[model samples]
Target: MPSQIHTTEAGFELTEDQNCMSELVKLCTDRPELVLFSRPRDYYWEDVSAGEFLAEVYALAKGLVANGVEPGDRVALLSNTRYEWQLVDFAIWAAGAVTVPIYPSSSPHQIEWILEDSGATFAFVEDAHNFADLRAFLLREDGTPPLSGSASRLRRVAVFNEGGIDEVTREGEGVEQSLIDARVAAITHADIASIVYTSGTTGRPKGVALSHGNWMYQTRALVTNPIGAVARPGKRVVTFLPLAHVLQRAVAVALTIHGATQAHWADTSTIALELQRAKPHVVLGVPRVFEKVRNAAYNKAADGSGVGKRVFLEAERAAIAYSKALDKEEGPSFALRMAHRVYDRLVYRKLRDAVGGVAQYGITGGSAMSPELSHFFRGLGLPVYEGYGLTETAAAACVNHKGGQRIGTVGRPVNSYEVRTNDNGEIEFRGPGVFGFYWNNPEATAEAKHDGWFNTGDLGEVDSDGYVRITGRKKDLIVTAGGKNVSPGPLEEIIRQDPLISNALVVGDGKPFVGLLVTLDADELSRWKEARGIPASTSLEELAHNADLRAEVQDTVNLANATVSHAEAIKKFRILNRDLSEQDDEMTPTLKVKRNVVFRRFADDIEALYSR
Candidate 1:
């Protein structure tokens, strides 16, 4: 297939009632006995059938309607990933309202901003901490906080961990179930399904208004594709990514539409334990999750004896070679195959056990994954298919599907989308999956759209086989004084691959040559110290100036520089005493580095690199 516009063949046509609630109704009716959700109770996993799931949604939808929720009303769900989040999301749709997801990590000001901006009438928070934060914002000044032009709209708040759903169900005692059905029936494809707010990297978040048709088209296109068929009936998925993000939200909807079972983890920290219990077939995650797993595996192997370490290294090399042969459609050598089989028993099986021992495929997104990590996973028999999209395009625009995947690129444009790059290298597309508009931001929406195409604000190219490779953010491109446009993202990805490095910021925009500011991974640094017999009492500042550590970082920089042209390569660099983190306002919720913030915070170090 060529890299140009590609569309799906017939027989995969979209349905008439493609709204989310209607699809849920059809799915429940078709597979009432099928287990849709496996939620963890006190000590055991509790299965919720399609029929039971719909029943709960009906009750919650009735509660919402009884509480004065009208069609098109904005309902906020501020919680972590749990079964309740999914229930509230569908319940909001069932009541003919739009769901507004709020990241639980948001500060009080951020929570207030989203609530006021969306004009949400009701909010569901996870626990007492979140409820307290929202209450503080609600009652900021003399029991009446100043809302940003949308205060009067919000009426009630519910806490999910404290019997809130039961209270809501009791409140709807007089409201008939038929009323909820009527609300669902009245919904059309054009109706707004959600107003998902973006995790603003530069400024305040913007709400991307996605219609029912938008999600329906993307969901159908995804579930019906040959690659998507991997998430078929009886397939189990372990989801730990935040539901607030569009990618995970789309995955949840797809699971429901395809009758796949989902097991939710309380947070990322519990993923390994949950995976062991669930033994999921499909895994959905961001790049950071895979990175952490890879790091853990590396650390484990390094902690072993010298002979064990050498054996592990040899096994990894054989696995990589075998994986490459598979990618090239060439058979592995007899010796290499035998070596890999032995390693499979020694090392590969243990790696698989870490991820529940049954993960056939993993879908990663939200950021660019290093090619090294992608190949490493594939070599372990767990191929991770990376996809690309934004909040505006309903999560996935292009993806690596089964049987026709390119390792480095994010595969072809999905069946519902037509993607092309402009003269300026900005990727643009127009498809059914495209969102309707930016909620309450007409000017911003207009600026983002030209003609019928939505500019993705990402720089990339499509290969001959239709695989798209993202180079960098158009806005984050660093043009040097020599007039060379350097993509810092690729360099940063390479630098982060070093176990000692945590995060990296590539600078030198308008400067003589490329420079970088790097931070050390605290855990990896400790491990390195222990291996070298260094005291644990060494401060981060002391380690930053250590001659041995500096030399290792220098090697990492050299490795990264080898990949780019001389003009775009790092000429000078400094290692920071501390790492960038979300709590420090140096990273977005999705772990993307906030370059401007980092630069401003470390102006002295950045200036010093250029001063010399």
Candidate 2:
């Protein structure tokens, strides 16, 4: 038997005295004038220098100290991804407190649970509306306000829209700067930096406790390594992903360390407009964002004239072929090169221009992207690097980056992480980036970790070259009544590539045959209805049963079926009226489906596939 373990040496390490706050402090001292961040104004963006940001952070830290916040206290931040979020986060750290982030979209029950679980006392929210909602939920039955240091220990709630930063700034003015300095000096690499909760795909969310050394080590390695070359001083980055996500937060920390000019964009609906305006050098997104961009381009091409559509189809084929050819010993042929060059001008250029026209490349995670789609993007002179990691790994343990890229695989271990496969083929990792434990959940932590290695629960394979290819979730395996096991991830990835399909959830555990539940893309469906001359007023529920829509979905299912064995193939499918959404509690903040939730919510629908 061959060895299953793959290990990469550590690229960087942290000093004993260094903490997450050290880099910002160093930047302010070394390059006070460097523009560290830019926040959007009414029309243009206003830049903030390193010195200015540090000053504000200190002032906020003083305020935190004045507000009865003690060292090691957990301060909860509930808001969207914006400048204030970063401000409060650093302020909490500077005050020698731990930051606990709650998703802005979280429900009242979730907010209560997280606050109670994390033992947070001070909270910052985004606006008046959110504050009002929070107040309403946390009020006592006797009508007393919860802000009086109630049962949950949450004493105060500040709203950004209500001049919360200014209020805090004013409160700390009388406080001495030496107090802030002393607290900063007291913090070390061993102290906890933040407690980020998991997405809670199954069961309740567990808080992943990451120490300052974990971040300092991981971020230093990221910048010093070849993969993070783009994170140098003066590089512009537009951060739109929620900071509550460990991946986005880690990237933000990495960028801040290198003096990159960061811009915060919270509204996903206007992300394209923001991206175009920022013209960032590197982009970071989830697989869904990239998928939407690809689907949009495909839909546009299809909606054009017949000649144009044919040209696009031919261009796509040429792009994928050219990308694949680059991997071979002999490069792309002269004919293919010529064809690619032509398409680069005709089709690829427009796609690139759609995303700011300046993005060198993109980094995507959260889910696996099909090899075909990855190739198509690379063929357009824009490679989308895919990384694989969990909340436990602090973002990326394996990544396909600049010089070390492999198209289909998430590249070798990063940040000195070691990867291995057990006899059952489940992925395991040990690295500086990995969190030490789950906050107040020792049982869960014990279950997830063995010795120094973290059990990832994800199944994968490691090639001779050390590249890691994720096969599927070990817990998500669907075993049929006949005992044939199938992984739904690959089939779902293929089916979702269809322009009209937004999501595909495969079902058939202990069933006779595989079945599927699919949801249509709202934007694509509207265009499809228009192109086919369907009534504009038709609702999704009405269209779900349409013969034309069903036939189109069946075609995608057929394509998926062709890739797998007969036992694993999807024999039937049902199109849902609406897309799976976070609001419905069917999806996590990271856009991963809550399988148990979906199974319960649509039990009848799932059973209907087999019953008929």
Candidate 3:
């Protein structure tokens, strides 16, 4: 049963109850056009505030309502990251309907599957990209089959980036704009919010039904957490992670309710420039970002043909010593301070300059981050506090409180959440923020909950101080024929610390020992080119077979292997140059590697690894 709702207005001026969806709407009512969101300079500024935004959205909701968009209707949003996508979602909620968000790059089959599964009465497409895909899937006049059982339930279609009064028709069956516009109206807590489908690497995608109360409830853990204060009312942040993911959405809109300054929405390319321009007090990043930054620093040092790299390392050592001395309550000795000053002026300053003066703390999430990356950032005097959570929990259940961050763990549960480890070490959560259930999938929902506790699906343990250390997924656990249990996520994380390695999936389940199949991050390798005089045209596949490169990777793998017992060490590894892309079913929309996909694709490689 759903718990009674409560809200708190302690630190925020918003609401006292966690389920105050109306208060969130009231923010829109009060400031209709206070610059709620803007696209990157690459895109145009809608310059909408809460009030005007809500007014227009409510008008659109009314439009949908008039078009027969009845309450509880599921509306699908298959669009790219943009303000309009949020608007459509907001409109869906405003109209007292459920929203189903699809990745902008979702294949035609997925589009139809979600539409059919959620019984979406309406859908908003971003542009020609998804619009074309949906068209191809739904209407193949040349005797081709529809992607998902004809999606007979779909009654209306809307474009997020454009406005039109005309309805679309096929075979004389028409869906009119007027019909969609009629069903939308003001939404309330009793209204369903969204039906978000999981990527479902293990099986079929399950629609995770989130309610207005669910979004509102999960937000408490984030808006009330210690780390949630990273960007206070006045702080600025830049977001690049896809808004389709709840993590990024919470940081953008949910945090807005907390009063944050939005500078710009960055293009996928100019994130570096965006950071420099925004000087964001808070940032969200994936492991790839950190790896790129680390590689750039190393390459710059290595660019002088080895001697320069050594000098850079020496300078870094000096800088760390200096930073430590400065942070010490007691002043450093004159001699040490003098050495530190020299290093600070030379190495550390340049490194900081590279990624923009992101001297303050930022966040790293989406997938597992290497502990070395965490320690490396700390060494540079930039705090990259790790956080762990899922969309179901609304972005953050545990985050390293800004004032007290652990180097490796994903910090403690936020003020609003309680985290405990089950007997199998899987993290279980009970919080105001936990989502209710998967949309219409009682079996999946049952599996995800135990009493009131939400199953995190991740196997982890808490340190004595309570920081969460994720080891692996319960599903990813490998029990050798000899009954030696191995959690691959830890080893995989350690392997990914190597700048050249973007992703590593360990396979050994039902086998004797572990083997690794890896992906080379081409960008980092391009940076490493100068040291070995490698040409720009060198392909990742070619690089994979390069003996010299293989030796370098082996050395990295060996170092990672040393941290664990011999039985758990990766017995063999093969470099895979083929990038695992979201389009190819290799990654979640948030860019987390799909472990099942990796294993299946590399079955031949795994067999080869064990052949000897």
Candidate 4:
């Protein structure tokens, strides 16, 4: 039997004086002129050097200090991923304050809960909309304080669109820079850096307390690990994933530590344009982003001339084949190599050009990625590495890296991390990246971490080669009437690959058979309808019952069914008239479906599958 436990040696030990702030300070001191970040300005990128960024950070830190922010104070930052998000984060640290990031998409109730829970004193909102939401909780329409004590500790709210950064900087003009330095120097590895709340795929979100040491450790681990090969200095990466996401936050730290130039782009709608403009060496995204990229390419080719479509199909097969061959002792044959080279120019080059001609590879997480999609990307000469971790672990506990690539697995434990499967098959982790406790939630903390190990609530297996393959959520396992246990994640991942399907949820718990509820991708459906000669303005309700549409979905379902046993296979499926969205509270900010929320909201739809 394969060993259940997998461990990786620590890349480097942290010094007592080192923290996330110190890392930045060291860079500014050592190489002040080094370009650290690029901010988009009218059509081009404006570079911000280390010294410039540090100076701004200090100015803001002084502003924060002059405004009564004290060491250990929790300051709230409500915004999307942008240059200012990073700016406010470091400035908070420089003032010896803990950051509490609230998603810009968060509801007023959610925002109030986080603010009250974290007891944040000051806050920064990105724009008028965000400010209005925060204002709703802070004051009544009459401009008086709200009745409740929720977030009462919050003293002031700053709006970025209203020149919040400039206001804060100006307020600190009289404060000495030495005070900011002293505050930064006072912070240590054990001091709490941020209280990150979980995305709450299930119930209420809990705040995970991450220390400065946790982030510093990850900064070192990322640059020293195999990933650092391309993530090192001079490389450029675009930051688009919400900074509230721990994965993006940690990656930002790593990029800063390694001197990589980062560009901030909050809007993903123009990701293609941003990618082309940044021309980054590395691209980072969630699984859905990669899925969209692949689907878009395929759909574009399918929509083109028949010859182009055929060439794309051939290129795709060749790529998957070439990737699989690389895994074997005997690599791709001469004929296959020749075919790949030809297709590289004809098909793959365009795919590469779509995401900037310079991208070397991509990193994806936040959910499981189908091996088929991973192999397809790898075949395109742009391998997309997948990693596994949660906000509790500060992003990635284990990640697939260059030269150590594994398609199905999330890869071995990262430096200084130990991963193992308990008797119940739940993945457990212990490492520098792991958090010590949840903010003011000792009971939840005790339940999650025992001795030194953090039970991830996710089930998985560690193969003999030490690769970690996630199976499913331990809490999400479904058992049929026949007592056959099924993990829906793998099947759902496959079903979601079809361009027309936006989301799939598998359900069979205590039922006689498994069933699926699927939502359609609106854009894909529009394109699909156009290609099939359907009316452009066809209503979703009408299309839901369309024979051709049903048949196409059935084909997708059949493909998924073929991959599993009859008991675990989806026996019935229904296409929803609408797609899921974050606004409906059916999806998280990271695009993960809220299973319980979906179950409740779609109870009628789910029941219809069984009643029939």
Q: What is the TM-score of each candidate against the true structure?
A: 0.95, 0.96, 0.85, 0.97
lDDT by residue (1-612, candidate 3, tens digit) is 322222222222223333333544656556544455545444543444556666556556666666677788877787666656666666666566777888776666677778778987667786666666666444344534455457446655666545531232121134344433343324444456777777656677778766665576556556655436643445666667777777777666665565455544525667777677667766677767776777677766776567777877676555545545544688567886666567657676776776567547667777777765665566566767778888777667777756667656788776566777877667887765677787768887898898888888888777666678787888878998678888888887778877677778888888888888888777677776755789988887777778988898899889879988999888888887576888788887767777877788878877887898
Candidate 1 similarity to native, TM-score: 0.95
Per-residue CA lDDT of model 2 for 1-612, tens digit only, reads: 323678655456567878768678988889999998999777888999999999999999999899889999999998999999998999998999999999987877787778878988788999987786567435465645556544476667889989998998899898898888888889877788999888867888889998887788767756654337678777898999999998888889888867888999988888888888888888899988888888778878877877877888899889999999999999999999999989999999988887889889998889898888899989888899998888888878888888778988887888678898876788898877789999999999999998888999989899987899999999999999999999999999999888888899999999999999999888888888998899889998788889988999998898889989988999889877678999888888778899999999889889989997
Alpha-carbon shift of residue 34 in model 2 (angstroms): 0.8
For the record, the alpha-carbon RMSD of candidate 2 to the native fold, in angstroms, is: 2.2
- Model 4 agreement with the true structure over 1-612: per-residue lDDT tens digits: 323667766457888789989888998888888899999777777999999999999999999998899999999999989999999999999999999999988877788789889988789989999988777556454545575544457778899989999999999999988888888888888999999999878878999999998898776776665458655668888999999999889989788866888999988999998899889888889999999998888888888877777888889899999999999999999999999999999888888898998988898899999998899899989999998889998888988988688899998888888888887888999887799999989999999998789999998989887789999997889998999999999999999999889999999889989999999998889888887899989998788888998899999999999989987889888887789998888888899999999989888888889996
Tens digits of per-residue lDDT for model 1, 1-612: 213654333324566566767888988998899899999799888999999999999988889888899999999899989999999999999989999999888877788788888988788899999888676445333435545443635677889989898899788878888888888888877889999988867788899999998888778767755336545578888878888989888888888867889987856777888888889887788888888887777778888877777877787778778877776656788888888889889988898898889888788888899887887788878888898889999988888867667778887778778887877877877888898799899999999988778998999897656678898898898999999999998999988988788899999889988999999888889988998899999988788778999899999999999998888889888988789988777887778887888989999998989875
Cα lDDT, model 4, residue 416? 81
Model 4 CA deviation exceeding 4 Å by range: 1-3, 42-44, 139-145, 149-151
Clashing pairs in 2: none
Least accurate 10 contiguous residues by lDDT in model 4: 136-145
Q: Give the count of colliding residue pairs in each prediction.
A: 0, 0, 38, 0
Question: How big is the positional error of residue 94 in model 2, measured in Å on the Cα after superposition?
Answer: 0.7
